[model samples]
Target: MLVQKNVPLQGLNSFHIVARAQALAHITSEADVKSLLADPAWASEPKFVLGGGSNIVLTGDVKPLVLKVEVLGRQVVGETAKAVIVEAGAGEDWHAFVAWTLAQGLPGLENMALIPGTVGAAPVQNIGAYGVELQDRFESLDAIDLQTGETFTLNAGQCAFGYRDSVFKHSSSGKQDGGYSPIGLKDRALILRVRFALPKPWKPVLGYADIDKKMAEHCTDQPTAQQLFDWVCEVRHAKLPDPAVIGNAGSFFKNPTVSPEQCTDIIGRDPKVVYYPLPDGSFKLAAGWLIDACGWRGKSVGMAGVYEKQALVLVNRGSVDGPDGATGGEVMTLAKAIQTSVYERFGILLEPEPVVV
Candidate 1:
């Protein structure tokens, strides 16, 4: 375990926001985690677990001790004629894992290529892209109980996955009569490792309309997993700003899902509204369409602005003219504006995907 105090978190998070953590610990093994938990210094203090830091936004300096998970390994644990079971450390980079799987001719995860964040955090949000979700390939995950300092294995069902949510995220502080308790800084449980079952023959799934169109345009009758992965990277690169170049999370808000009646009412106002029918008999509206329709694209407030290329992304355009250049971008306010605009335009609420701090 490596420990530091008063660490700058600006570069750690993808958003490039300047924030500080009172203490930060890098854990490379389960034993290291156990040792840290045994320390009296952290006994009652709040704790925060961070991975690649792609899916989080720090509003201000975080008070808790940030534990950076560094445990790393990838192995093919089991194999059959049709499928293979691969286990990856929770701290492994998600995109790196996807590339590795594709290199090994694994069929799944191609659609999730170029996604930021770590493997451990994938199940927390049930990360998805291009019509594929992590839950579809997830087998199980090993998590450490913060209270008992014991590890527990949770199957897919045990994870209680919903769209962009999981038991780890919803029940980080355990369950309550109303629902899962609110997540507290120190009380959140930690993920250790994840197991995925991927197909062996490596058949690609081309469900997304844009991806399919791209493939067809290229005149490729049978696009390999690598080809598909490359295409996804290109698409994402074109649509989303690279956090390294511009400070922004990939997608700020999830596409809102509403009842059929709600969709009808929304479309009754505008006939060209884009929507996708959900399996639950609901309608999922395009959040970007709504934001763009509201004329927020490329709009800026101080240093914060919506990405011109993709309205779903909010960007930080460097320091604003203020004393000490202290006028930092406000993501919450922009998000709230987008949320209110969507609500007013279509009477549907848009929820942010990134964890707000």
Candidate 2:
């Protein structure tokens, strides 16, 4: 329950933005949250739960009591006819968790390998890659109600998952389904751990051109889960700048989903628009394509730049170890500029993926 004051956050966030938490506390268990809430000085304070810091943008020093989730563990917990249940601490590295699952002969999560962030942060956005999403394998999660300190568990149905979104992303104010039935969690819940139902008879998810190229290179139509994992990691590395070398928060914007008529209109605007049809009949336009079409690739607004290889990723062009690196303001400036350019050209406003704090 020790709350440290003025903690530097440069080493914590993947973006490597220089910022500090006014006061920070680490929680390793449910009891930590309960204890913090029981304290008169901090019980009534607003709080922010921090994890791997791979999916956040810190505009400035954090003012709320930052709860650094450090809870840790992972194991195969149970089995059923259709799947094997696995449990992981919310604080576990998401990529590490995926690798561990594979080491245990679990294969369903391979397509989502190398995604940056913690397991707890995964559901907040229903993280997906190649052809798989977290919701596809999610089972249940244990969390604490920050408002009342009540421990509760939510199954996938109760989670109300959708493309890159979940209950944790919204507030308690009458937010509708797609995220939750009627109540949204947003700053009101703190996840402790999560459970996943890895498919029993694991099947590979493929068909993306990047993956197809990998398959072609290997000269195999039927690829193993490990192969899929390695390909995903390779593709990501080739297209993205590692945060260890360059400051960035993966894909900066979400691929916008558009109606059929809208897609047709965009196609008329540019016949070569990269898009994929969803099972629901809607079309998802590539945000990267839109940005690249706007001629933003390798462009910079101050110290923040659009990744040359992938227009969807805005990067910090400044020295990683220097204080003159891209500020949060500069990153947002570039992101907003990209958003505006895309909207003007295609009538689709690209939504940013990171949680701007």
lDDT of every predicted structure (CA atoms):
0.81, 0.91
What tens digits encode model 1's per-residue C-alpha lDDT throughout 128-200? 9988899999988887766557776778887777889887665335545643343431346788999999976
Q: How far in Å is the alpha carbon of 81 misplaced in model 1?
A: 5.1
List, in order, the clash count of every candidate structure. 1, 0
What tens-digit string does per-residue lDDT give for candidate 2 at 5-86? 9999987888888899999999899999999999999999999999989889989999999999999999889999999999
RMSD of 2: 2.4
Weakest 10 consecutive residues of candidate 2 by summed lDDT: 173-182
Indicate the worst ten consecutive residues by lDDT in candidate 1. 319-328
